[model samples]
Target: MRTSWSPAALDAALENVHRAGMPGLFAEVREGDRVWRGAAGVADTATGRPVTADMRHRVGSVTKTFTAAAVLRQVESGRIDLDAPIGRYLPELVPGERGDAITVRMLVNHTSGLAEYLPYAYPSLKAFPDLANTGPQSLEDHRFTRFDPVELIGMGVTAPAVGTPGGTPGVYSNTNYLLLGRLLERVTGTTAEECITRDVIERAGLRDTGFPTGPYVEGPHSLLYEAWFGMIDPPRDHSVQDMSWVGPTASLISTVADLNRFYGMLLAGEIVGPSSLAQMRRTVPVVSQEGKLIDYGLGLYPMEAPPGRDVFWGHGGTVWGGGTLAAIRADGKRRMAVAVNMQRWNRLDSAGRPRARPLDDALAAFHRVAMYG
Candidate 1:
């Protein structure tokens, strides 16, 4: 049975998130024709503008879902084969036997065993033992720099593989999606941005979601603050930066409402066909550095709901200075989209692993309200 959303409870939860350290938060909950929106804290610290549900924010790696969908669309059209090795499409770029062994499916499921390039590309974090926990200081010099996807993939391919392609547990790598983006272009003979826009965004009727060609977000949006654990300074405004560094993988901007609609339609089999959707939901156990097991599919993550709540399927994304969480119940009866205009919520321990902080509690509270309230 589905429960009606309690606006009062949701409002209180948003307030707690603001008090817990987020500069601002905007969220939407939808069940059939009924929708509820809420916000708290200041969108701009200088002017103290309140965040609104319609405000656009960077959705980060959630862009992968769209990319995956575009690829699947090509597969359905017979332009691309899921099991074919990526080297078949981009042999010049993804050379060697390892490339030949890695299939399109492996890339989407993060089983390609590719190393991420960000840590090695940035000079500041070169000595940081764990690149996964690299902080904002590492990116300060290149925040506005434009990066070519080919160059990014070159850096990653030069690094050692995490494991044998398709033979080991998935290790999350931004490089895999970067390559996938290139593969999409190779197969479609169109830019990744154009393909995603037409195939996913337009098809889903998401008016507020887009791939920005420049650093500025071109609509009402919250100021993104990065608290890099005092590495550069706390609550530094990083709302604008050239996102080309993570192109096609983590560079899409969207609003809570649009995100909810996208996920709702996606899980309902509106975006991709039944066969492709089933392939997307096929799960593999991915063990994180913290030793937690997460079930990851093609581009989606299946998050088990709290006790007594229905399981939700979707994705969560975090960029330099913002975060997004979008999910819908398996039955498609309930959906939620939440965006926080702050990043690096958890403090890094001496080993460079994230440890719990106030922001974690705020996120948990927001999820509880969105999923179970």
Candidate 2:
């Protein structure tokens, strides 16, 4: 029989990850009946700080959940139409013009056939990479390198069209979520930042979730180390504020506790109606890692992990510096979230590049809560 791990086991594993590699990491695990939240390493390995639930970390693409929620809210309010050409609202964004024959649906589902950031990757990783400054760039500054949302939009414009108007699907392009973020900003008079705060955060009663307006909040925050690149030699020197410019595409930092509370409220209909939430979770077609069909849900990615009887639904995020994995069981009784400052999505092991489906081991530990720890 397969051995099951425990919450304690998961904690130990996280601590192992902390000691061996992730020096500045905090993990939060909320299971069916118990909760274990701990700071594995230092928030700032350099200065020595502990990570707290209030500690903020850039959520990266996980911010899509917030952007999705806002868009669905608009859909719920009749302010936007899912099938309505994204151009009806933003004419400059008309489909098929910029190699994107995407409707709002395609944009959210990552099926727009746009390039992902694997410019020099396994095959197709055109998710936006800077060819000009790939050499000796500070990890932090290299990513937060300033550019408006419109510039990000332009990145989508150049992404090679993979399929004929969403015909052959199966590429995870960050541009789709990026476009959704921009569309949300345009449809609403307020920016995605303000709307997410007012509509999603406050409404969901998520005290720990909020946007990083400027430099890191003058309080405790997770000081991440780029284990893959910025771990030694010359460290990426820049504040969290520098990375916030990614805006709806990436920005929107929050805590694990807040993320758990937010997703919990979302599943429980506390923040959004059933239809609106359903709209956000709308699943679409995509090629799986196995080269089979998979469900790339709207604003959310759902998959059935091994060793589990049921599917875990949620989203993950990746930035230049950090990565996050947040998931909730189908029953809504189990919710887990883990955010790590170490983003080595491109890390390669002996077998190949090791790709960890994360919530910082949140779900793995969460799975243990039922069987062992």
Candidate 3:
């Protein structure tokens, strides 16, 4: 332990993020046997409902970690091969040379060179590839839309490859995870949600974490507000929107405590075997959806760390108005899981790049104290 676990310091850090324009947020920080949970701001601006640490939240692509863990469980059972091409399991979905060229490991690590399907599926969000463009119109247009995973896979597969398979600086794409979802179904003869829930979520005993059954998040939760970088003037509440568009990739709803628990067990070799965990810790360069190169592993990535600070392994995810980050120190002792009700704060520059904001530094400082202290 650091010999200095300050609950007041952690609370102040969480408060700083809220002061930096976060609508609402909650977090859980653990140090050895001690645990601290905190929340700040309002859950609903209209109603002024205060946020709480126990609220369930739409945890975005953090679902990838659970999905990757499920795949590794299958690997342990001899039902799947990590190095084998995805085509072997879902040929009809990822056919021919492209499928043969991309392996399960590549897909898990985001090195498969698949272009993101978001720009294709939500054409309005084309502003994504070109950050200077504004397109929150499609967000509301498809709020209730239920997209088929196979159709989304087609959009990404048919799109031009971002790079060669097994290449460095891999582009992060939800399409690769969508295919992994289908592969899970093809092998387990069940929905990807069911397989992951049974194999990883249930195995880890995450009571507040599971795939959303529909447009509504069950149990108590905060209203999610999306800023869209000022595209939507006042920001809009997307708390009840359907999440099928991201499905097994980013649709899981959970809480801060559950997230911390999941990572703790995951790092302790309780959720996956030692070999599988080692493979997950193996890092490679991959371009994150945010357009920055990050050290990504199989469904996991190290949160950005300052020089001389200990590295933390986990994942961060965002969907519309919500975002969550769950990370555990490499030594598996310190951990922090945070969920925010607001997202997309940075204003785009002339070249479509997001300008740095005080909020960014505020959040980073919070992570530093939460994980290291």
Q: How well is each residue in 1-373 modelled by candidate 2, as lDDT tens digits?
A: 2334355676676666565555556656666556777667766667777656457777877787777887788888887787766666666744456333467777677666665433422122212222222332344333434556565666555656665445546556666666676677777887778877888888887766777766564456665555442223433424354554456766777787787777777877777798777776767777642245677776676656556355667777766557676776665756667766655423334443344544436435443443233
Quality of model 2 by C-alpha lDDT: 0.62
Window of ten residues with lowest summed lDDT in model 2: 122-131
Residue 275's lDDT in candidate 3? 97
- What is the full ranking by TM-score, best candidate first? 3, 1, 2
- Local distance difference test, each candidate: 0.85, 0.62, 0.91
lDDT of 3 by residue, 1-373 (tens): 3536999999999999999989899999988899999999999999899999999999999999999999999999999999999888888988999889999999999999988998888996872447776678888999999998889999999999999999999989999999999989988999999999999999999888888888998999999999898777788999989898999999999999999999999999999999999999898999887778899999999887777877889999999899999999989998899999988888788888778899999998888888886
Whole-structure CA lDDT of model 3: 0.91
Q: Write the per-residue lDDT of candidate 1 for residues 72-95, one digit (tens) a residue.
A: 999999998999999899897789
Q: Model 1's lDDT to the true fold?
A: 0.85
Give stretches of model 2 more than 4 Å off: 1-7, 95-100, 116-145, 228-241, 287-294, 345-373
Q: State the lDDT at 91 in candidate 3.
A: 84
Instruction: Report how far residue 362 has shifted in candidate 2, in Å.
Output: 12
* Candidate that beats the other on lDDT, 1 or 2, i.e. the better one: 1
Error of 2 at 303 (Å): 4.1
Model 3 ranges with Cα > 4 A deviation: 1-3, 127-129
What is the Cα-based TM-score of model 2?
A: 0.80
TM-score of each: 0.95, 0.80, 0.98
